[model samples]
Target: MSRYEVDKALWDVYRDASAAKQYRRDPVGFLAPRDLSDEEREALAARDVRRLVALGSHPFLTYNFALRLAGGFSMPFVQDYVGQLQGLVVGDITT
Candidate 1:
């Protein structure tokens, strides 16, 4: 129920190189200190963008974070990220 924390986590990686490196090194560990629900932690670790969206994280941040996870706007990753978000509509984003 904490979209603020969830989106902060996404933004951490999306905007900071150290955070992104930490994420690549240890996804769970990187998020361990964040005030996120277990479900949120699992979703982020698993890179489950759809689940994150459903959890109310900002879709734009989620998409950008996915690109970071895919090593910066590269192939296959972009396609995979796109697939996860296919046929989608952004829902309530209030945090």
Candidate 2:
């Protein structure tokens, strides 16, 4: 059941080419966190794949926002989510 919903939401979200539009290269707008269902969280946890692969597929916005967060930006609720998502990919300088 969890996997079903995860697959469904991922497919639904990814199938749209417009998902990229949300990034817009605006660090403020792009790195905001968002609510997620259990499936969504689990899906992200299961893989390091970029959720915004349909977007510009770059990490600059995420990386910059992470630096700001580390420097003590007051993150909105959405930023928390973005942090988690970005953390999945950004932690390994060794890689």
Candidate 3:
């Protein structure tokens, strides 16, 4: 099974405003029942966008999630997250 079940779950939450609101209010409780790995759980708890992207989360979904969690978009945050993804991709290509 794909480890991205967590990503899909996050996307589902982001797809619905009510769900996203609930998630934003209590992210740990929201994710507590899901069958996510430690890394996935930690990433969500920490709001670690870069780690999520590096772990193969869909960038669009990740961005949406971040925006919802932050109550708006921040260009600097997106730039940093995308930069991390670029670094990971470049590392993969080189290795």
lDDT agreement with native, every candidate? 0.89, 0.38, 0.71
The digit string of per-residue lDDT tens for model 1 on 44-75 reads 99989999998889988998898877767667
Best by TM-score: 1
Tell how far residue 16 is off in model 1, in angstroms: 0.4
Error of 1 at 53 (Å): 0.7
Task: Please identify which of the two predictions, 2 or 3, would achieve the higher lDDT against the true structure.
Answer: 3
**TM-score-better candidate, 1 vs 3:** 1
lDDT of 2 by residue, 1-95 (tens): 23333333334334433433343233233323434444445333333234532122234433442333344355563476465565453332210
Residue 80 local lDDT, model 3 = 65
TM-scores of the candidates in the order shown = 0.88, 0.25, 0.72
Query: Model 1, which residues run further than 4 Å from truth?
Result: none
Model 2 residue 13 CA deviation in Å: 3.1
* Location of the lowest summed lDDT over 10 successive residues in candidate 1: 69-78
Where does model 3 exceed 4 Å of error?
73-86, 90-95
TM-score quality measure for candidate 2: 0.25
Winner on lDDT between 1 and 3 is 1
Q: Could you give the candidate ranking by TM-score, starting with the highest?
A: 1, 3, 2
